[model samples]
Target: MNEILNNLLSLHSESEIAEFKEARNSFDFNKLGKYFSALSNEANLKKLKCAWLVFGVKDNRTVVGSQFRTNLQDLQSLKKEIADKTTSRLTFVDIHEIEHPDGRVLLFEIPAAPQGLPIAWDGHYYGRDGESLGPLNLEEIERIRRQNRASDWSAVTLPSASITDLEPAAIEQARENFFQKNPKLVQEAKQWDIATFLNKAKLTINGQITRAAILLLGKAESSHFLNPASATITWILKDRDGLERDYQHFGCPLLLGVDEVFHKIRPLKYRYMKEGTLFPEEVEQYDPYIIREALNNAIAHQDYELGGKITLVEFEDGRLCFSNVGQFIPGSVESVIQTDAPESRYRNRFLIDAMVNLNMIDTIGSGIRKMFLIQKKRFFPLPEYDLKDNRVQVTVIGRVVDMAYARKLAEYPNLTLEDILLLDRVQKRKPLTDDQAKYLKSLGLIEGRKPNFHISAQIANHSGERMQYIHNRALDDQYYKELILAYLEKFGTAKRVDINGLVLDKLPNVLDETQKYNKVKNLLQALKQKGLIESEGKSWRMSKKI
Candidate 1:
């Protein structure tokens, strides 16, 4: 702390990497997060290791003391508050308090943004311009992101590693996958020795083991050759309450370990109606290809440099989460789905190519898109990607999330996968951009306003979900008025509360309480205007003319 204080004192002026404020009583939590993003980005741009946010210091470097976040608990809560809103849940690296004869000073150390990824607060990139905190300029955001175009880490050769470090069993599996992907090489593959086979399979460079070979085919103990890089995958099974039921960890020679991990997962039977058929078809809860693709992608993209092992977790409730460390190369899954070819840059080019040559993953950049399509074919929820914490987490749901939505999908085989994916988002109540919403609206495939959308009546009715269709559809105003009139006639009179009690629950559950109330109010106004009923003080009654 003394050394850091001296370093700041040496600067003697607020710059891009340092900000000073006299926060004697308190400071805005959101503003603190903005500073976190701004300072972190500024540090990255300035090529500094850390940025500082000092409280209790004047612009002129005078220490007046700070009562800001004086309570230790409140001060700690700031970490969670800031992390929850920032990209990758980034928060202060450390918070230090030093008591001086003049006053107590708080120093917040913020780590620089990761290479190629800028820090963002609540979706907006932030940076410091001189000493002012604000949105990161377009040029700066691009500058940081461009760093991703650097050389791939996995492609680098391991100087001392050799074929001896690779397990024979893993090499055999790799050979089989290689031949399976390239059947023309079957006869030739059988004749090649281990060294020749590895070179032919792209797993080795001139008989010397590359990082890719060590990662995928190295013996478990030989993982140390990658020093500080983790070559392990952890699979855990959890109950509904999130209690772990079982867990198994697999080490290097992931070529064989991936299969072991797959074997541990118990994908039970899930029965759903076959498209256009009344009879149900029983299929495995998870598609085999989908599982392999997800796992292989994790292995191929794992940021070994980050020293975090891949994790795959299965829940009793029928969902699988595959997680690996590193920024998602494309940044968003949508980008991957929309792109015409493989990503131009990868964290592990050699490893990914090896996986591709082994038929472990598709090299055409269609793996994620294919996973979504397979889930869609099964009438299951689309795979979800949660990109944060310098990691990518993918969740594949086994069961149908919305039966009505799934049934609609089955009934409309003509709908494109993209359309089905967009509709799935609607059914799940996830937000859609204006362009997506507009496209669906134009096709009459979805209705209601932006953000709160439902399957269009045309689709619902065609799909044989007339009930859901009717529920979402608003009936003629006259019909609700008739219900109000009938209630009035039955009891001779009724209060507004009584009328609401009779009709609110009967209204579509999709409408919120406020919308339900508004519907009931509209009905009453319609009835009164038509002279069928009149307000009798707080009560409503049939008109005497009736």
Candidate 2:
């Protein structure tokens, strides 16, 4: 710590990659976030591993004490707060607190912006012009964004590994899949040796094994060939409460491990009645194609350099979460779904190509969209994506979350995939942006205000969701007031508990217990304000005016 601080202090002034702040008592959070963005972007542009933001320091290199976030808990919480606002939730590598002879110094170690992604704070990109902080220029942003263009980690050759390092079984399976994919070359491929076949299949370069080969076909014991990068996939079976019931880790060759991981997941049967049929329809909890596509996509796009294993978590509630370490290259799932086209570029070009050639995945970039379509067709909730924390996680819900959503899909076979997606969000109670709300509202398919929307009455009637809609819909306040007045007239007086017992269950189910209580309180207050009811020592009675 002392060495690092001395080095920073040795600098005559703050550089592009370092900022000094004399937060003697406190510091503005917005300024701190801006510095995080600027320092991170500057570090990436300078090709440095990290940047520094030192507290309790002056621009002239004088050390003064800082009382910023004196509490350790509050100081540590800055990581999440910063991540909440920064692009990809990028945060400090580590925060170092130093007790210097001159004062208490704090060092915030900020990692460089990731390749292809410039750090943005609250939607604005920031950079450093010497010591001055400002918006990151277009050229600098493009320069950082273009860093990913030439890098292909999977295509890199591993001279240390050879055919002997790969599993014979996995290679044979690959040959079979490849033959199926390219039947015209079967006779020609059959005559070729394994080395020639591997080269033709794009798994190797000039008879030398590549990381893609190691990941897809390397022997389990040969995983060490990748060194620091992991060629592993972990499958965890969790109960409804999220407690791990069982777990198993499978290593390369991932081609065979995919099947092993798939079998570990129990895709139980899910039964739901068809729209009009009294009989229930039974289907596999998860579609086999969805499972393979998700797993293969994870393996194909995983940031192996991150040294994190791909994880597939199966919950007893009939959902599977497939996660891989890396950013979703296409940026957002909506872009992929909306465009329904191949991505312009990929992080693992070599690996993806090899997998596509083997028929393990499609190159059309419709895999995720296909997953959504399959879920929609089955009347199951669409797949959910959580693309944050420097990782891409996709959750496939096998069972139906809301019968109303499934019924809606079943009855309205003509509904566009986009409409189904927005409806899915409504069923999940996720917040909808203004445009989304406006579009849904314009279609007359939803009701209520932002964030508390419910299926409109017309759709609810046609979809057999009237009961659910009623539960979500609040009755008119006048009706509730009338009920209260009638109760007071019949009972003469009503205690708070009595009023709650009368009205709590009557309120819309969309409001939680707390909200229900608040609603009852508001109702009584409104009546009191109108002079229709009066409070008499913790009880209520009809007012003389009424």
Best by lDDT: 2
Residue-wise lDDT of candidate 2 within 315-372, one digit each (tens)?
8988899999888888899889999999998988999899988879988879889999
State which candidate has the highest TM-score.
Answer: 2
**Residue pairs in collision within model 1:** 88-389
Query: Model 2 off-target regions past 4 Å?
Result: 1-114, 117-141, 273-280, 433-444, 448-450, 463-473, 543-546
lDDT of 1 by residue, 1-546 (tens): 968876786775899999988899988877888899999999988888789999988888888889888888888788888889877677787788888667889999998887677988888888877877789999999998776567566766777877778898888888889889999889988999998888877887777788888888999889888775788999999999999999999998898988999999995999865565732688889999989999999998877755678999999999999999887878788778778478877877778888889888877878888898888788888998999678999999999878888788777878887787788788777889999999999999988765557888888778788888778766566677778888887889999899999888777655778979998998888777888888888999999877
Q: Worst ten-residue run, lDDT, model 2? A: 272-281
State the lDDT at 98 in candidate 1. Answer: 84
